[model samples]
Target: MDKANQTIQITIDADSGIPIWLQLRNRLVYLISSGGFAPGDKLPTVRELAVSLGINYNTVSKVYQDIERDGYIASFRGRGTFVSDAYLKNEGSAENEADSLIDDFIRQCRELGIPRQEISALVERRLKLTE
Candidate 1:
């Protein structure tokens, strides 16, 4: 396996009820944030990733577009896609970065059909576990 494939250990759980695109997007975000991929690291092309993951090309393309819009990655015509430097710069503001992460988490939970109260309760439980 290549470096990108080795570094990114994403798995699609069709039985988990989560959309494949969301799972892939979330995993990529987490990998980027956690330093699994560095700035300027090249990611697989949309068509390549789609074929590798055995999913529709449109799905991978959508995930890449969404992530690029969020400043986590960038694409260059002919050169391919790469991890963006913006995520590294955003790390300078820890508070804002944390808030953004929380917002993303909540948004993803909502997308998964989780209720607001349930989300809050889940957070509280997780917080208590850390205490």
Candidate 2:
């Protein structure tokens, strides 16, 4: 299958404190931010995703709706849902999102009593791995 037609996998925990739909949406956001979905890429239909993930159609639909509202995806009648190029035009939105995630990560680590120096070292190491 082509890149746009390939099935992307996302795990959900029905029993987790977080809602399953939120999990799906957050994962999608992370994937999009990490360049998994490219400009004009087509996402699987809500029905397809629901069946693939074994979840309710409405749940998947809700996630898609939210993502669309976030300006990450767009739908065209009869053309299917596509990755929106809005974020490309709104450059600050993307960077600010990545920054917010990093800040949240740092806060969580701090709450867990992880030292800033250790966090910095770990981030540097992780960044190197991505390269």
Candidate 3:
């Protein structure tokens, strides 16, 4: 795959009130966890990503470092960074993947200014509709 083209899928919202680094990191985590990126998939370099997103190189570098530490990606000395297999090992079942996705959803809801109680109520209502 052309890693450069893949960067098109990532976008930054300057008006979102969230930190740019957090936005990038969250998007990457979401992509990886949701299987938009598979294990061993090559990631764009920090410089390339920064250029593509029009952000400072240091910001992308920092997010990469943090995500690498979190075990979501691994960087080889010369081969570039790739999506880590850690999540594959950790999310061994559909249930576990669901749990991770739910955690992401809750975090996003909170970020959107939804209170926990309201989130719970919304979830309950949605579940009832399905039932």
* Top-lDDT structure, candidate number: 3
Q: CA lDDT of 95 in candidate 1?
A: 93
| Residue-by-residue lDDT tens digits, candidate 3, 1-131 | 56566688789998998778789988898888887888899999889899989999999998889778667899998899999977566665888658755876797789889999999999999999999
Candidate topping TM-score: 1
Error of 3 at 121 (Å): 24
Give me the runs in candidate 2 sitting further than 4 Å from their true place: 1-8, 89-131
Residues 70-107, candidate 2: write the lDDT tens digits. 78899898999988867555566767778756875786
Candidate 1 Cα RMSD (Å) = 3.8
lDDT for 1 (candidate 3): 54
TM-score per candidate, in order?
0.68, 0.64, 0.66
Lowest summed lDDT over 10 consecutive residues: which window, candidate 1? 1-10
- Kindly report which residue pairs in candidate 2 clash with one another: none
User: For candidate 1, lDDT tens digit of each residue in 26-60?
Assistant: 88888888887888889888888888788899999
Off by over 4 Å in 3: 92-131
Ranking by lDDT: 3, 1, 2
